[model samples]
Target: MARMFRVLGFFTLVIALMSFAGDLTEMSLLFFVQTVVFFLLGYLNFTEKTYILLFWAYMVLSFLGFTYWTVFRMGLPF
Candidate 1:
């Protein structure tokens, strides 16, 4: 069960990264939602603290990338 969540989290992370290739609005929304889902899965299913920490790192990085693309690249005030 825990292993399944880890695998799902990895796949979700990959999909979230791939979403960067799409429209900025869509990418932000998709990545944000995916990150939240991954975090939830990690918190609930991961026994090891390392997995949870890794998910948090990935989520923070994903948010930073989204912010950069939306604010700097796209010239949005957000």
Candidate 2:
């Protein structure tokens, strides 16, 4: 179980890093990954607040990464 969890963590990290480098084509994939992170954290036996905190932190990081990718790749800002 521990080994499986470690492997999954490694996989997620890779995905997250790729997500930082993706364009709009991968936005949905990034969202899916964010959803999975929430799902896994939600299943924890800890407090609900912990889940909320982790989710928000993850969102902040994801938003910054995606925003950076979009702004640089799309060059859409006026």
Best by TM-score: 2
- Model 1, 1-78: lDDT tens digits are 456555676776677667765656675567568666665765565567766676578669979997898888899555
Query: In model 1, which runs have C-alpha deviations exceeding 4 angstroms?
Result: 1-47
Weakest ten-residue segment in model 1 by summed lDDT: 1-10
Clashing pairs in 1: none
Candidate 1 lDDT score at position 78: 50
What are the per-residue Cα lDDT tens digits for candidate 2 across 1-78? 323334555576666666667654465476457546544654455565665575568669878988998899789869
What are the lDDT scores of the predictions, listed in order?
A: 0.68, 0.61
TM-scores of the candidates are 0.45, 0.48
- Residue-pair clashes per candidate, as listed? 0, 0
Please name the candidate that would achieve the greatest lDDT relative to the true structure. Answer: 1
